[model samples]
Target: MVHNFNSGPSVLPKEVFEEASRAVLDFNGTGLSILEIGHRTSLFQAVIDEAIQTTRELMKLDSDHEVLFLHGGASTQFFQIPMNLLAEGSTAAYLDCGTWGKKAIKEAKLYGNVEVVASSKDRNYTYIPKGYNIPSNATYFHYTTNNTIEGTQMHSIPETSVPLVADMSSDILSYEMDFNRFALIYAGAQKNMGAAGVNLVVVKKDILGKAGRPLPTMMDYREHIANGSLLNTPPVFAIYVAMLTLRWLKQQGGVSVIEKINDRKAQLLYDTLDSLPVFHPTVAKEDRSKMNVVWVMDDPDLEKEFLAICKDNGMVGIKGHRSVGGFRASLYNALPLESVELLTSLMKEFALKKLNRICLRLFLSRHCGLLLSLPAR
Candidate 1:
């Protein structure tokens, strides 16, 4: 069986896929495909409603928050958030942890002053910045909870009084945390939530309409919330699939149960990496991501050969990003522990093979030298 380790558009539960495939053909005995269902009809409405409600329940959000399924992925929120929250004169505090956070900082600058509270760019973002002070007067303190490309994660929320905003695209629902602590949380559905084409935004109701700037109807969070995330034709099929995944998450006993499984999977892989001398982990131990574990070969020349072995063994998307040439194994919520176990086993086998080859070469070299010294025998 193929093992999927892709970072985005990543693995989902097998049951979710089965249910989604059936809906594409015939939905709920309605004799109509989910793809063709009218978004405003009761049928699609129930799908969106459950999707939102499940999200709220999983996160244990209160009535003060609103969940929205929007059109653009998390990337769009980089700019849209500032448009709705950052005003002409106010400043927003940002923590630049990695690529996504940098992009967010760039976008926030367009709307208002952006004060970078801390950044780990000096070291290629291999670690999360700590002990930085958030500006008290800033409109909101924005941070990316998990850095997918860099394989770094913030294990705990920063203590701050300013409103908190987080881009949890890669790690949402993978662990349990105080979901209500953030004034706003956004995630692209493809990573841990569901298929592509839908973005999940959870915002506190009070945070809206305070930016003091007139936003275009489509750019306004209030408008989307007001319309129940149906300001326009929603991504019908994507939302349906997301609903299925969320339901699956609930049936599996919510985030608390899944978090433990995710932890075990991550720990097993990390332990393997730590024990192998040939492999080198990229991120700091404290900052290593539970979702994305990145590492490179100590001898870079062996990377291609290792990747080849992984491919031959049915591993997919084990290659890292182009910016960082290495391996990145994405352990998403739906990824079973068996996949990680297989990967770790492969890694151990590869290391042993290399060591055996080295020993054979040394043995041959020593014996050949002795034979040459014997000369005319």
Candidate 2:
């Protein structure tokens, strides 16, 4: 009954958990634990194959795109991407939407010239910036589709003929979109996809080997893709768990169906927040994220009390990030609507209780004053 709202390493399906647990003890009736399986063995190969295939199917990717499960998380791609695509003299355009985007811009600068096309930092990244022109000669235009920390999302793809690159770590596969438009897309599996220790990268085949810079074999996306993401010992257990999660996604009728459910969950929670005066959503209405919903209490002092109530009621990881202190509720694909419902109900109850206490205080102050004036009682 514990409701997990963690932004990363977030909730996953119950059935996926059960299957993964079983695999840990006995993988597909093989006596060896999934952890003990050889990475080069046919068994492990099949797992990776299915994982990649499921990802392709879910995203409706074509043969031109190559899927890879690499060693480092998405943060590694912040530099690896530039190493593989942004040549020494070339410039890459970036959209600074939030923390991750800013980090990406910093990393890209190390490889080549980086032009910040637009940024929402002026307003603390509460909304996505618009109408910025991408440089015509830029190698690629990069952006983070969803800002988990800021709780804002870019609803539409930027109109750019320059190759599109995106860090979709927080929102990948959470909703349906034109997956093929991006030349490269990378996501840390911890958020909506699966466990930690693995990062998913999907790159169009034609985009590789164009940077004209020497890259370490490990840092080269082409090397990883060429070997089918087996350039080295892969994260066997994490990949297996991610495979199970992808299967679970397929069983739930694919992204299109789940996107609707995600929408409904977000709408219900947003409605509850809007109806309550005590709670205030931080991001712009149009830019509010469907995955991570960030908000604050009108009275900052009430935050701790509300968080305490949530913890007492079995809600975990409801506190927001340290940098942006308030509250963040991540509604991942695996999180049930019932959890959101319970949270909204608790918010309403808390707000009503606060109102009742205020009314009682006001009444007591007036009555006490009247009595004191009338008599020395």
Candidate 3:
């Protein structure tokens, strides 16, 4: 009965968890655990191969792209992408949408020149920056499709003739997207894919080895691609969980069908938040995120009380990030609409209770003639 809304290491489909549990004990009746089996075995090789194909199928990517399950998170790609693509004199363009975008830009600066096309930092990244100019000769334009920490998302990615790379760690497969538009797409599997152990790299086959640096075998994307994502022992259990998630996604009608559900879930929460008088949404109205809904109450104490009430009502992960200090309900792809409706109801109840308490205290203090009022705090 738990409603999972945590940002990362988020909720998964019930079916995925069930299927994964069975595989761990006896994989394909091999009598050996999926955990103990050698990565070079045909069984494990099928795992990596099918997982990549499922990912491509879900994204509707063509043969122009190569998918690999690398070990490092998307953060590694932030620096590695620039190092591999940008030569000594080359520049890269970045849109400063949120924390991750900013990090990618900073990492790129160490390698070569970087152009910040646009930034939402002036507004605390509450809105997406648009209509920025990309450098004519930049190696690539890097942007984060969804900002996990800030509860913001760029629904329409920026357009660029240069190679485009997206940090889709928090939004990969959450909705239907033109995967072919980007030269590279990377995601850490924690948020929407499966878990935190694996990172997905969907690269354009023609874009690698452009850098003249002496790159090691492991650092090079081509090496991992050639090895089929098992240059060494891969993350055994995480890949299988991702495979299960991909399978579950297919059963639920793939990305296009799931995109509609995601949009509906976001709308349900957003509509409720907009109507409530006590809670205020921080992100700009036009830039509302479909993946994560961030809101805060009029009073900090009230926010705390509301979170406690949500937990009491079997709603978990409703607490806000400590840095932002409000509330963030991440409605990832797998989150059911019932969870959104339940949260909206709780929000209404919390607002009503606060107002009732205030009115009752006011009436009591007013009616007592010359009586000192005691603060509830």
lDDT of each: 0.93, 0.92, 0.86
Local error of candidate 3 at 178, Å? 1.0
Report model 2's TM-score to 2 decimal places: 0.96
Estimate, for each residue in 57-151, the C-alpha lDDT of model 3 and write its tens digit: 99998998999888888888888898788888788888998988988988899888888989999988888887778887888888888888788
- Backbone N/Cα/C clashes per model: 0, 0, 0
Ordered by lDDT, highest first, the candidates read 1, 2, 3
**Which stretches of candidate 1 lie above 4 Å from their native place?**
366-377
Estimate TM-scores for all models.
Answer: 0.97, 0.96, 0.95
- lDDT (tens digit, per residue) of candidate 1 on 1-377: 99999999999999999998999899999999998989999999999999999999999999999999999999999999999999899999999999999999999999999999999999999999998999899999999999999999999988989999999999999999999999999999998999999999999989889889888999999989889999999999989889999999999999999999999999999999999888999999999999999999866669988999899999999999887779999999999899999999999998888877766666766887632222110
Q: Kindly provide the TM-score of model 1 when superposed on the true structure, using C-alpha atoms.
A: 0.97
Q: Which candidate do you rate higher for TM-score, 1 or 3?
A: 1
Q: In candidate 2, how many Å is residue 290 off?
A: 0.3
Q: After superposition, how far is residue 201 of candidate 3 from its true place, in Å?
A: 0.6
Cα deviation at 60, candidate 1, in Å, is: 0.3
User: Local error of candidate 2 at 178, Å?
Assistant: 0.8
Over the full model, what C-alpha lDDT does candidate 2 score relative to the true structure?
Answer: 0.92
How far is 135's C-alpha from truth in model 3 (Å)? 1.3
**What's model 3's lDDT at 113?**
88
